[model samples]
Target chain A: MSVAQISRNEAQAPVEQREALPLRIVRRLANSRELTLFVLVVALALAMTIVYPHNFPTGPNMRAVLLNLAPVGILVCGMMLLMIAGTFDLSVGSTLALSGVWAGVVSGWWGWPAEAALLIGVVVGAVAGLINGLIVTRIGINALIATLGTLTIYRSLTYVTAGTGVTPISDSFAEYGRAADPVLRIQSPFWAMLVLVLIGGWLIARTRFFRQFYFVGGNPRAAQLSGIRVDRLILIGFVIMGALAGIAGVLGAARLNSAVVNAGVGIELKVITATVLGGASLKGGEGTVLGGILGVLFIALIENAMIINAVGVFWQGLVVGLVLLFAVSLDRFKTAGRA
Target chain B: MGSMLKSTLIALGMTALASAVTAPARAQESSFGPADAKETYYWISNKANLPLFVQYDYVGMKKIAEELGVKATGGRQVAVVGGWDPSLTESVKKCIEQGVPTVVDDGDLPASGRLAYIGTNWTQVGVAQAKKMMEKVPNGGKLAMMSIINAGNMREAVAGFKAYIEANGGGKYNIVSNEDDGGDAQKAAQVTAAILAANPDIAGIAGFDSESGAGIVTALREAGKNPGDIKVTAMEQTPDFFKTAKEGWVDGIVVQNRELFIYYAVKILHDYNHNGLKSAGLAAADGGRPVPDTLDTGVLLVTKDNVDKVTAALGVK
Candidate 1:
């Protein structure tokens, strides 16, 4: 009986082969873009280490790089999610400025508790995002146009709140900006970033609602046919992005001990660059939390190395732009190969 | 006419004598009546922030006008020709175009056609600041000059200081850097931090503008460096800046009286309206003013010793 069964299975092996090959190919292609980006990040890190053996490989230097990139990392996480959901939030930088200014004004100028002020800032950001979502979805405006409008409005709001200057935060709030303790010697923002990354990773990987996000971005018509709440998901994604930007704003304000009206000027470009470099397609539906963190770290390391090498400030922007172009090109090549 | 003519001649002589005496008396009594003076003058400024000329300095001149019972009216517009360079070239151009007879400038006005240039002698200001810095840092050390914006005046100030230092025989002092702070306090602070990190031995820093000074003070405090460690000097006085100075975060500041600029500018404008540039040579009592071309409105050195007094005088508690 066992021999007869084995011969029967051998006869059906070609049928199974016909079923499995295409699926395997598709799966490999799906992961190829992210895998290539990951390799590039590792290669860049290795190159940095080789160039600055004494500082790049050291624990202190690595910690500094991580700490500096924490805010950028948090922002990129949200930016990637938004991109995955097929929307752009150019107003994140302005939102960050507004949140920071409000937080500083509420707590510093008005002497409110830090916790309350932070809550209000986050809420304000969420509300702003909601308005952006409504403008994009309900009002049938393009995400880019809606966000650009909010960007100017929010920036102007920041100026008004900050009275066109820097508003200093309280000492206690500033303490939150410093490194946690000697044993860790890592800033509070670093810890917050790690937690945020973990939570974002879980949301993206484990939840069914989160899975719906990919479908919405991948094919909105198909997702709508499949009974996914596409509009709601997009709105929620924007809300999360806004909230994260708010958190970043507060962290930045705390670190600087002052909320400058121009606090997050040009930050949107950096965050978007990191997201795109992390393999989050501008076309939508592809990104990873780990990839975003690595992207930010790569940029931070380059900046740190440039500073350590005593490069002129004027050249910094050009160098960063070139690096961004290179990363985007590599991403495109990898994506093309996968397709 | 001899006998009867003798009588007639005596009468004619008497009549002629009477007519001559009356004519002389009438000439003595009939002088020309007093003429009415012109009451309006045209004044112009490069921009509202032309500082001593149009803003704070104008207040003092307005008071002088009121005291002298002169009617003055003019408009302050953004710099028409020059943005930062307050050269008389633009003012001269404006004067000629507007048919302005007399002109008073904050020294930025071109000397051409202007009745007077009544602002600080910038070169002298630079020399004075440099001299003060030298006095503060006798042994001489590295100094950084922070400009609000890298404008012409600041460049001139730096040039003046550099010339003075060079002329006096360059000693232990050198200008380590000249950073543009963009008049933003945060940026100013960041730039100062970078400068300090790059040149830790900077013994003195001078701010060419208000915000830069505040930024330098903040950076110094954060770096755990004392005011004495780096002799800091800046232009103008704000409440916060004075507080910092009181706490010894600043060595001294060069305070210019805006009143002087206003008073002189208006007076020069009046002189230009009535007497033109030539009449500006007349004494103040004689309704004549000095068209020094470059006026030293005056500067006060505010140090720890005089910080309180100056603050009190400025009413900045």
Candidate 2:
């Protein structure tokens, strides 16, 4: 481990020295898709603002968009990391449901403190992820199949936990969803998501242990020869993904003031779509925190625009489907260019 | 090996016993009311999770059954036939072919030998809801109507509402947009949210079903829009709908008595199965079995003023 760290540090020093203006620009483009998506998002926002000048550009409407993105944005960070690590976790949606139900059952039904319920949710999520990681890595099952199985099982568990009704949260717990201050008028979830994005970005870029995540994902055999514990890294990644999902779940429950058994259904698809759209390759080892956030923002902007434009609801699925196809096509073009 | 065989035999026996216990008792009663024989009524619905036609309706019918000293039970079963029209017609045909003596349906089914249709008058309900909305917004702005499916009873309901809006209200009422949510609340909510965003000036919205209604209400609340800002109406008397009404997010709901439908349907089936259609005196009109060609089980208009009355009637409080 010490030898691998020294070698990686030495590799980083040379790359830093070789960095020039053109190289920096290229690196910036490569590392963050936000520039492109930010422009697109701004254009869409402007269009909406023009169409519905009275309502669309207002502070409250902007706050609504940000608030709506909070949970998915947070979950996408973990999803991007997992995708970068060369694995997928479709169980996050189910994990979200289970975590929310667990929290609600504990706090609302069993009279547990909201804080304790949240803790339990995160721990349980991590445990579930650990099991998934072990099965995928040790038993050599495909991550997709393993996570898919867990998805069904976990969703069924949510049904069993909540029965059939929405489990209402206490008023005190619901207050967590209120705005932190008047300046933003955005809910706590949005602020928490920003903090998560920063931490995630730092972890991916600055941490020595975390740098090994890319190598392990890029090539497990090569990473193992470099003395990185690939299996353990994968396990840790899954656990982090699960914990983030749990936090998102708890936040969702708080925001809705109820833990609906169906709260997070199909969320995994959205998270993965955002991660992939952000330039994360399914083949592994390439994605950035900033890029993932931009991807989420872009998708969210589309949703906001659809709503603002009064596009019929049936067209939403069609629009999302088309966007996903475009993103995949662009990814192929980028990969071909690199090759 | 002998012990294993004995255990296997016992397990098989237990399995058979369990199935027997859970299976519907054969319909062999002297009359529609309970006799020495135990009769079971099997009712099938389009969706298992239906809170209204399946749950509330069954509960109401069960009460009537108990009053008449009969045993009643319902299960979450989908029609082998799909779609509102075919499903309704097929359900009736299946019931007749399978010798299901009496079948009560929520939608209009092909009348062969079935007992009755104890469901909402979809056309009337839609017309009534539309009339109320027209009264509120006399100039009739854009109205959005949501349905679970674009077929059968829902199609009829929307048609009825549109007819009334067009004829009586003139150019005042116009259905600007319609959406089918596949009867899923989350999908319905998403659809409603999108619709609300697109047409903020929409004067009224109506959800043709319970889940859609709840979804529309949730979407409205999420958007921070007041219920009165856009007149919203829904069908069924669910706790969520009741709360939405109380909170002033929903303007009104058309309530159907599902219980009465089920109770009478079961009774008619029992009578037919026991005495045959003719012997039961169901063949002719007035003097025969009291199977009205179209029994108006009746509907109640639920609003803020009368919500408490409806809730109390449904024992929701």
Candidate 3:
């Protein structure tokens, strides 16, 4: 099945028809949550183009939109997987801080190469994720409580580690994050996020390994009865969440050119909001990486539009909250109509 | 329990209790004010997680307090602080409850029954930044402001900035946008980047807080724009401000000296307690009028020409 229909497809597939490319693409689009988002995005983009012909449509502003969305896009991949598996990672923002700060310490203070610092950051993220997995899987703790504990621990660690003001990263490393494509004016992180999305989408579609995630989340007892290693899969899902947060942290610190202690504050809330708005349910087994990435794009567009229109900065939060509410309500209305 | 162990436990408990008391150490009643000058003084700011600058201000208060053989009190270590976290109203209530000689800083709560306020006038800080911006764009330019709009000081600053532009900017200095960064460097960079993209003609930025320069500089650097491309005036300084300012990303800095702030806050309270408001020169003796409730500790405008000398003199670098 295509990624867009991951846990939502109700009909059993016919071997012959499923093999047809045109049929599969059409079938997915007909039911895809992402299609609605794509339409909404394009519509909004066009509206913004008309309203802000001089400002919004320019290369620099468009680039800012993409750059702003890049970190969120990278996060959507792992978060989507975890959401589909009936789990949440509240500590992702704190994990991002912990990873980024540690990597910064090694690279900047300890005088290690930037590459080593980057690796350490990603590794720290993986370890942090693995710990959350162990607590939830082995200790039978609630994912919420387990991750909440890690959240406090990690954010406090960020303060302890990054507490001594801004820890400057290597100049070259920061410059690399800012490097852009000449023609498009889009930065490297945006391109990197696109690749992650493609890979994430492919993982959900082509592999039975990924397909089992739907089974595990959609019906854990059934998945276990079918001999799926449900615990191991959940563990891997959490690991992916952590590692991705790590990648985002490295990019975040590099982009800002310093390890900022307050950098990741409230980000997990934003990521979770974006994930749910993208059509994921907290109950589990109902989201797409594609939808989540688009959710990132949609939010960035709103922020840009609000600023260009000279709306009060305080209204940005209210608008975002309303969008989230609207998106959830639409999902609920759809489900109720189906019933 | 063994007798020796019991005694050791008691000793440790007593030590912990003593240190806890010392953290918010109440001073002995000595001769109060500058002349007789030995007493405990309390400086209460609104919040507990004191920013670095505020800490420096408190340190300066301590320096003077020591010079006069007195004690300076209240900081993050003080079990209770009046920042907006729990509401300054609650902190003020606590001050009244504990009978702490509280001197409110920056933010005023006469309703909280504060004895006095020692801090800069935020509106003037805003005016100073606007003046700097105006000096740069003598012919006018599209200007954006990065501020924390809801912050009490920021509200004053924004009001001052708007007032100045209206009165003197001659329609040249246009306040096209106001972006509240919520003190997030990353968000600041993103907003700055967006403002630049949208307003290609944007010529200057007035940054109203500590992190604004850091965020603006990062955004400008990534956009491949030089500091010369835009005139930037900001409040406070960050670690990288030294290089960023010298390189020209920051045009002028409005410095609110923390030392002078704490010194005056404590001294005013001390003088008031000793000789009364009139004797402390906080009240007009001739007219029986009140000294202005707010004190503008004042600001130093540091530009490229004097940033080094100023920062060096301030010992910030």
Question: Candidate 1, residues B1-317: lDDT per residue as tens digits?
Answer: 34565445544643463343233121111111122313533344433322223325446646755654654444432111222454556556675456544544434555354445565555665677788788888888888777744455666666777788767736778876766665555456656765665565678888776567767876666555765788887776344356567877777776667667655655655554445434445653344544454455766767788888866865754
Tens-place lDDT per residue, model 2, B50-113, is: 4354346656555656675665554412111112554466556665566444445566664544
**Model 2 chain B lDDT-worst window of ten:** B21-30
Candidate lDDT (C-alpha), each: 0.66, 0.70, 0.73
Off by over 4 Å in 2: A1-32, A178-180, B1-125, B147-160, B179-197, B209-227, B236-240, B256-275, B278-299, B312-317
Assess candidate 3 and give its lDDT.
0.73
Candidate 3 lDDT over B167-209, as tens digits, reads: 9987777788989887677788888988887788898988887
Error of 2 at A46 (Å): 2.7
Q: On a 0 to 100 scale, what is the lDDT of residue B90 in model 2?
A: 54
Off by over 4 Å in 1: A1-70, A184-186, B1-317
lDDT of candidate 2 at residue A40, scale 0 to 100: 63
In the range A142-233, model 3's lDDT, one tens digit per residue, is: 99999998887776556555453344677766764667788887877788788889999899867889988888889989889999999999
Better of 2 and 3 by DockQ: 3
- RMSD, one per candidate, in order: 22.0, 10.0, 9.3
lDDT digits (tens) for residues A1-339 of candidate 1: 699999999999988757477666644543554565556567767886777566456554555556657778889888888888887899998888778777777778779898877787777677667767766665567999989988987775664445433335777776666536566566687888999999998888788888787888798899999899888888888888889988888887776666656666667888988888776778788777777777777777666655445565557668889988876666655566567
**TM-score (second chain) of model 2:** 0.77
User: Chain A only: TM-score of every candidate?
Assistant: 0.86, 0.87, 0.89
Clashing pairs in 3: B46-B82, B46-B83, B47-B83, B57-B258, B140-B172
